[model samples]
Target: MKKRILVVDDEEGLRLLYKEELEDEGWDVELAASGEESLDKLEKDSIDLVLLDIKMPGMDGVEVLRRVKEKWKDLPVILCTAYPHYKHDFGTWASDAYITKSSDLTELKQTIRDILGKKP
Candidate 1:
């Protein structure tokens, strides 16, 4: 089965872009515009991994990550954010990988493969 990836980001453009890019790399991409939606999807879907963003209006990514870790301890989560400083935050330590947002997506894809134990 194809790996299912849940992308949680407040920006619509980024979500769409990631969905398209990840889909091209043979992943089933699911998008959630907010932390609440992300949690909902996690409950309803068999997601293999999560690409999470910080600095949202409602619930921040760190809080969402905490909730996810509480419920789904084995699920791998990758923090993909514009702010690199969040890497220093203790809350982000629970995540499987932390990546800075970039248009190139090369690093992000590599991280995903590494965490999933798949060859690129």
Candidate 2:
């Protein structure tokens, strides 16, 4: 079965964009507009990886990542943010990996593949 990925972001356009990109890379993609929506999806289905946006209105990605790691210790979460390290330490949030929002699409793809242990 193809690996399933959950792309979570408050911006509808970004969510759609990432979903399309991941789909093109042969991933089974799902989009969530908020942490609450993502939590709901987690309850209903299994996901292999999460492309999580750090900044959000309710329940930010850090909190969401914490929750995911708390309940499902092995769940792989890849954080995406435009913030500097001093603003928000994506690494401290217990994510498997991170790529700045400004990062190249190729970099993000490579990061995901590396974290998933697929030959990159």
Candidate 3:
């Protein structure tokens, strides 16, 4: 089965871009405009992974990452941000991986592979 990924970002353009990009790569992608919306989606459906963007209008990625780890320890969440400080924050939250918003698609895909590696 194709993996389902939830893409969370407040920017409409970026969210749509991700939905299109990841979908083209054969991932079943869902989008949420904010962390609250992302959490709502999570409550309604199961997602294999999360492509989360930091610096939203509210409920920043760090808070969402913390909550995701708290409620769903096994879920893999890759945080994308345009800030340098988030890398440090991600380490503290035990995030699966942290990618700068300018990150190359190849690296993002590789991180996903690494996280999803050997999973039954």
In the range 24-67, model 2's lDDT, one tens digit per residue, is 98889999999999989988998888899888999988889888
lDDT of 3 at 21: 78
- Candidate 2 error regions (>4 Å): 86-91, 118-120
What overall lDDT goes with each candidate model? 0.92, 0.84, 0.84
Model 3: how far is 117 from its true place, Å?
A: 4.4
**Residue pairs in clash, model 2:** none
Summarize candidate 1's per-residue lDDT along 1-120 as a digit string, tens digits.
888999999999999999999999889999999999999999999999999998898999999999999999999999988889999999899999999988889999989888777522
- Off-target runs (Cα >4 Å) in candidate 1 are 118-120
Against the correct fold, how does model 1 do in TM-score?
0.95
List model 3 lDDT by residue over 57-94, tens digit each. Answer: 88888889888889999998998888867666534357
Per-candidate RMSD, Å: 1.9, 2.5, 1.7
Output the lDDT of residue 75, model 3.
Answer: 91
Give the deviation of candidate 2 from the true structure as CA RMSD.
2.5
Number of the top lDDT candidate: 1
